[model samples]
Target: MKNTSSDIEEYLVNVPEERKEAFKKLIETISENLPSGFEQGKSSGMIAWQVPLETYPDGYHCTPGSPLPFLNLASQKNFIALYHMGIYADPELLDWFVSEFPKHSSRKLDMGKSCIRFKKVDDIPYELIGELVQKVSPQQWISLYEKLYKK
Candidate 1:
């Protein structure tokens, strides 16, 4: 069954107390590392941090006046996934990810026009991930996005 926002929240709430704490820590780390102005919201059952409307008036759909997400985090039945939006738009970044984190197979990347799916918290390189987040300030990311995804 496709999970919804409520479902995901409920799942997180019911996790073993220990795991729940770990999840919270992970969430906190992500929030702390992300650039300012990235708002968090529930979208399609996942916790997402996205570009503000002013930055991408059209949203993730690349449509005007739509609410879109650039990144998402979710706890699934078996693992957690962190979705990164730049994987598809920034070839250099993607290449860097592959070269720097060679242990992860290409299959781990669920490439969309701008999404990188990472299963399991351990599957990610937290330091590098933080660097990725820091590399493009929120404003810069939005501006680059506008240029790359002009519609």
Candidate 2:
């Protein structure tokens, strides 16, 4: 499930033609709204934003050598998948997103525990994602991560 490729450009080059622009826009929305201290790179075969090892030396408990993933944006076989760790771990955040989704997009949400799937692709809610990106900062994620997963 993890592509060893470190190059994000190569990852984008392979996204289905129809999904490319929207995918890129989501990336832009996240990058623009992301707070200080999280780094963007390729992780788990997707374009990801994470708290770097420098900021959180413990890394991911599931994969200690890797950065602690906050969000991962991936082009999947069936849909665009956005995996956001905060919303999965934080009840208030999850509720906020579930409530706000309808205000931003008419399509009913297709979501997993932490993964938001945009099967229609064209209807992906970029604004809501931008707001979600701003919801958790690096320190907040690290503190939450330690409490929820590092044990």
> Top lDDT: which candidate number?
2
- Cα-based lDDT at residue 4, candidate 1: 59
Q: lDDT of all the models against the reference? A: 0.64, 0.91
Candidate 1 positional error at 116, Å: 5.2
Candidate 1, residues 45-95, lDDT tens digits: the string is 777777778765667654556565667776666555666776666788778
Off by over 4 Å in 1: 6-11, 14-19, 62-64, 102-124
Model 2 agreement with the true structure over 59-139: per-residue lDDT tens digits: 998997889999999988888999999999999999999999999999999999999999987799899999999999999
For all candidates, the clash counts are: 4, 0
TM-scores, in order shown?
A: 0.71, 0.96
Best by TM-score: 2
